[model samples]
Target: MPLALYLLALAVFAMGTSEFMLAGLLPDLAADLGVTVGAAGTLTSAFAVGMAVGAPLMAALARAWPRRATLLGFTLTFAAAHAVGAVTASFPVLFATRIVAALANAGFLAVALTAAAALVPADRKGRALAVLLSGTTLATVAGVPGGSVLGTLLGWRAAFWAVAVLCLPAALGILTGVPADRGRRETSGGPALRVEFAQLTGVPLLRAMLLGALVNAATFAGFTFLAPVVTGPAGLGEWWVPVALVLFGAGSFAGVTVAGRLADRRPGSVLAVGGPLLLLGWPALALLAERPAVLLALVFVQGALSFALGATLITRVLYEAAAAPTLAGAYATAALNTGAATGPLIAAAALTTAAGVLGPLWTSGLLVAAALLTALPARAATTPGRNPEAAR
Candidate 1:
């Protein structure tokens, strides 16, 4: 890979770490902030909501700016949000900071996808995106675990501080390493945004992208509560929880790589495989939660399948939205953020009335099934055409 790509990946690593650290720190945060664990989970939901709202809004506003400038500005915003979050004593303030951080994160990722596509040749887009997205997966494997450990030992505030600290270098890296690109062609007048929105809506492929997002959200609903599920009913210690997360993260890394390769070879087939695997894995995840050894194995499978689905869906969206790739990418980000926001809320609701951890997992599985059904229309509507370049 090129050095620029590596730097972008590093920036992504920082961003991803900042975004996901909340999940691991939820228990510690709840205790420190004097809120219920359920409330602490809302921090993640808040960030997701911010991301959902920010991606398109930022994209629309920044439509005429150079891609490099947009990316750098978003990174700066991400850094600032983390810094504020680190120092805030008030819970509401912290929540607001999370929203700011999430918005920046959402914008950063949307721009980054567009930048990554521009960085590489058309044929190599999938691989390039995979490399960029690997940063998020790496955060899951290393950053989240480290953040959790740091928060446990030093207080959850320290974790946020660490994320804030990393932002400085990330900003510097972006300034130094990211290449400048010409501004995107903006649509003329007030009708432009409406036209773009209408174009996206009219596309069957975009609907598939949204469905993909829903599936991803449904899976996360269960996964977000993973620490509790493992540490509580599953009878694992806190120390063991991070280990399970590491296993899941490792699986995600493999899944993403495989998905990229498969997407290059056969996009539709990869999507088909991912949907069934996800549907099958959730029930298995529920069953395996009772057995430590089995649960460990299942966690790996769940992470792999879930992330595989995500990567495949992204590649499909890129392909199908070829006419308006940048806008399509923004739409994809929107779907994902929407899912991120929905997952935790849904899981939290299920946890209230349903039997143990099984409730959330079962509910998530059913939702994923519905998402899978949405893909059928997508597949029928947008058949994968030859793209030999994608294989490259």
Candidate 2:
């Protein structure tokens, strides 16, 4: 692995922190902005909406630019978005800033994944992606909870300020670390965006996209409301919210580590087994939410399963569309964000009924189970000699 990979991960750390920190700061943000909590919640969806649209749009716009320049530009834009967000007292301005930050975040992630895979051997792409994604898992573990504490003490704006400042070091790393020549090289003469997207409609690629969305949908449905889950149902104190989040983050980090090592050799099996395992944790948590120990245990397990298949899914899609790794990477980001945006709505709908906040857990579990079953038919397309990208 190269030092540049870590630089990519560092950028992702800043992006991931901003992306998820809002979940922990919801109450403070709502009160400070003088809006309903529901309106505050929309900020998360707003960010996701930006990512969903921005991934492909950025990929297309920067398709001709050097990877290093694109990455540096995106990181700077992200830092500026946070700076503006930190100063703005108005809710609308803050919301718009989130969209801007997410657009840059999406572009950075899509380019980083493509750049990462290009730097490594085909066989090691999965592990490379794991290294990149570990930044996000680490963010969930440290950044989100730390932001919550910071919000409690200094105000939520402080967290944004921190994220903004972190980008300076990350930008420097990208400037000095990644080789100029390496960044400029993508698969030369690859198909155009339209052609690449058309090719992406193959069965295996579609399945990978659907699976990514469903997995995130299942994961976020409960995660978006984790603080309440811990304090209300698990009977934990306010302080314990960070502890539980740490536990979940720890599980997610471990899951990514293990899955990275296995993805290249057994991606299909990873998805098949891990998806259902993920589903089980949800029902267990839903049934045992009132039991502190059980709820804690289930949260760890659920978080592990939630992220375990990530590298595998990305690897599968890249394999299916190898010639257009950047476009495929953009699509993967969009798919996950699409799910992130939709999952809360599903959770909200479930909460309106007798199911309550815990309803999301059960609803998410069913969605994961169905998603896994839906992916079964795509197995044949993943076999070694039948690669869609190769055939094309």
Superposition TM-score, candidate 1 onto the true structure:
0.93
Clashing pairs in 1: 123-389
Best by TM-score: 2
TM-score of each: 0.93, 0.94
Clashing pairs in 2: none
Q: lDDT by residue for model 2 over 329-376, one digit each (tens)? A: 788888788888877677767776787768878878887887778777
* Residue 249, model 2: Cα distance from true site in angstroms: 1.0
Output the worst ten-in-a-row residue range by lDDT, candidate 2: 383-392
Residue 220 in model 2: shift from native, Å? 1.3
Scored against the true structure, residue 199 in model 1 reaches a CA lDDT of: 64
- Judge candidate 2 against the unseen true structure and give its global Cα lDDT, from 0 to 1: 0.81
RMSD of each: 2.7, 2.1
